[model samples]
Target: MAAGGPPPVLGVDACRGGWVGVLLALGRPSVALFAPRAAELVARAGAAAAALTVVGIDIPVGLSAGGPRQADLLAARELGARRSSVFRTPSRAALEAPTHAEANARSRAAGGEGVSAQAYALRTKVLEVDAWLRDRTAGPRVVEVHPELSYAVLTGAPARHPKRTWAGSEERRAALRAAGIELAGDLGEAGERAGPDDVLDAAVAAWSAARVATGAARSLPDPPEELEDGVLAAIWA
Candidate 1:
């Protein structure tokens, strides 16, 4: 832990400038910050990094070589109408491709469906996180997370509105409050750069990270698949 308190947990989400991270301790949000990279965001926790319990991030951690990940399929199934939020992760080969056309071709050749434009757009962030995890030293247990899945588990149903909408943002905030984390007052520059949805997503990801620390979270695939580099391919909530 950090000094005398329990270990801190983190939730991170990709934002316009870079990444938004929420650090929680004793089940409450302690700080929120924005960083240009994942490592810098984690370093925001300082001493806590050495004893950080879990880190939940809204990105695909492990890429499948053969086809679409079962974890993504299961998360979509769980979301029902909100299933579209869970994009199919491109195969490792597709992720390494230089262009969308190349990615789609690689995906198809690997027995996976064509990559969606949205999913393709995230290739950089996905690969960044993947590489980070591979080179990570012993600090926190990082896991793949989906904000929609976290919100669904918290509210006991899929979110009724899109996160970018006012109603949807309100719904997500309510879910966070209901789970005992409140987001109020000023959040400094972090709040300025990240959108409301990005903040909310990071908050909920922290909630899931707490659950993971306490052994209460559930993975989309109970037995998470392992990538060759040893990253677990599963979405936890």
Candidate 2:
């Protein structure tokens, strides 16, 4: 930890085998960890509870029962052409589907627009984090974030390339470096455990987490709303 710096913050992103966490303490470079479930990630944060002040994850935090969340709608508008990056989170019923087909059906039944294949693929991850949030007694320590939106906030404009591409990763890395965030060590390790883009996303998420801890972050849907389970439904960047 740096002298007189704030407490640590955690930023996470779902990856190939599970979730990738980037822990940022006292404004220094971050440390990365991998977990197969949100529970494992939460446990890691809990273990160092005194050091951890905020958690920013690249996943939806709260869910709607049968419609689109206002936060999702606001995020889409902010992203413009990249609006597609913000998928409409399906209702809780849709998130429990056993298959993509069933997920879409359940989404429609729940009065949502229906699920996308990309969104459907995230159902398990969603449920994992959702379950943890529902059981959380600490009043919203973990908040939702989107890598694209975070990048946009950092660069002062929308990201120009898709994160899956080399150009995109380089662009985001450059932005982070410019912001004084030294992505030290082999970020490739993060890619190896998760995917090529995972490390950068996790790093940016940590940056956002730090912002949240310092009260410099912003949220979609301003005041935020509550999920059926009472979790706040908002996205931060």
Candidate 3:
């Protein structure tokens, strides 16, 4: 770490190809990389990984078996109109189901609502993080973060446009700039593969990760409920 500077932090977001990660150190984007797997991305952080103080990822972490997680409920309430951006996580049983139909059925049986195809689609990634955390490789530093919430906190309101839209992209970038993190020039191969929204989401996630590392971030459901296995069922932003 630089003299009197904040420890390194990482922000990661899932993309079409794999995952896009942005490493922030000394209050700036030090490097960006795209990895086919989450662990690979952390490894690519190299020396930064050793002292990585926190990692904020745009994915569900701790899961619930009986119903929707309180973190998800609180995050939705916080987003207001943008609440749709926050997908209610399916029960752990649903996530482990064999097929989408079965998953939906399991979710409805547990939570009183069927799982959406969109939310169900995240099962693989959600399970991946769950396993990774269980192994304790990146467990201690990893925290679930919703990019929309990070942006909402940054701009004092939920974003006014959809993330995939041009206007929305600009809105997110502007928020990052206002927070003193600039995304300019060439982003190398990773930036080329990941969508504009993915990159921006990673950047803001990194901003939140930095906040988390420095003890400046807040968690939804403030106290953060813990799963039976000790994983936190909360979203920090």
Candidate 4:
């Protein structure tokens, strides 16, 4: 058989009890939830590996040892009041802690501003993706994405309400439509399948994956940083 064409783009968002993934391929969108692990999630998205191009996720990748990552800083500056959406990623050392208290302590010891309870809650998920990327032989095409950042770009203004609210979800849907992304299926239905916020974030991630594949997306740091352990760190939208 002839070599396959580029892989389709995928967008993933962490959900209530698992992860929500959106696969946009051949102009079709499919959603799935992966609770077992991040590796399984990526594998599902890469079922057609030869055709996989970009995988966008709403989680922190490539961490900073001290202070905030260049990408987080940039995202905060652009997001204004909504900047809290961009949580500071903990250093690898800090992530070794087994508890929120320990992680916060470790984060401070590592020279960061200390991990928040919100950031601590995501430790397992972040570590899952971090470990998955570390073990990938071909390196991962994964990019960090913030749905709010994508929405801001789409609407030319910061989001006014939380994504969990009906108003926020509608705003997101409007932004998606404004960006020209086709939502063939009902967004509310998609949210029912996962969560309103999760589905919406995944949709934005998928849209960003398309942008990355087309070279139209801009990353926070322009050129991303590659950690010595093979993690590529950058937030794109």
- Residue pairs in clash, model 3: none
- Per-residue lDDT, model 2, residue 156, is 93
lDDT of 4 by residue, 14-93 (tens): 87667777766753444444545666767877774446788899999886665667888899889999998888777877
Model 2 lDDT on a 0 to 1 scale: 0.80
Q: Score every model by TM-score.
A: 0.93, 0.91, 0.93, 0.87
Give the C-alpha miss distance for residue 137 in model 4, angstroms. 1.4
- Candidate 3 local lDDT, residue 113: 79
**What local distance difference test score does each model get?**
0.86, 0.80, 0.84, 0.76
Q: Which ranges in model 1 have alpha carbons more than 4 Å from their true place?
A: 1-6, 27-29, 47-50
What is candidate 4's CA lDDT for residue 171? 87
Please provide, for model 2 over 30-137, each residue's C-alpha lDDT reduced to its tens digit, 9 standing for 90 to 100: 577778886687567557444577888998888888889988899899999889999998888888888888988888887778789888889888988888876767
Per lDDT, the best of the predicted structures is 1
The root-mean-square deviation over C-alpha atoms between each candidate and the true structure, in angstroms, is 2.6, 2.3, 2.1, 4.0
Q: Please list all clashing residue pairs in model 1, or write none if there are none.
A: none
- Positional deviation of 211 in candidate 2, in angstroms? 1.3
Model 4 C-alpha RMSD vs. true structure (Å) is 4.0
How well does model 1 score by local distance difference test? 0.86
TM-score, candidate 4, is 0.87
Q: Which candidate order results from sorting by lDDT in descending order? A: 1, 3, 2, 4
lDDT of 1 by residue, 99-166 (tens): 99999999888778999999999888989988888787766889889999999999899999999999
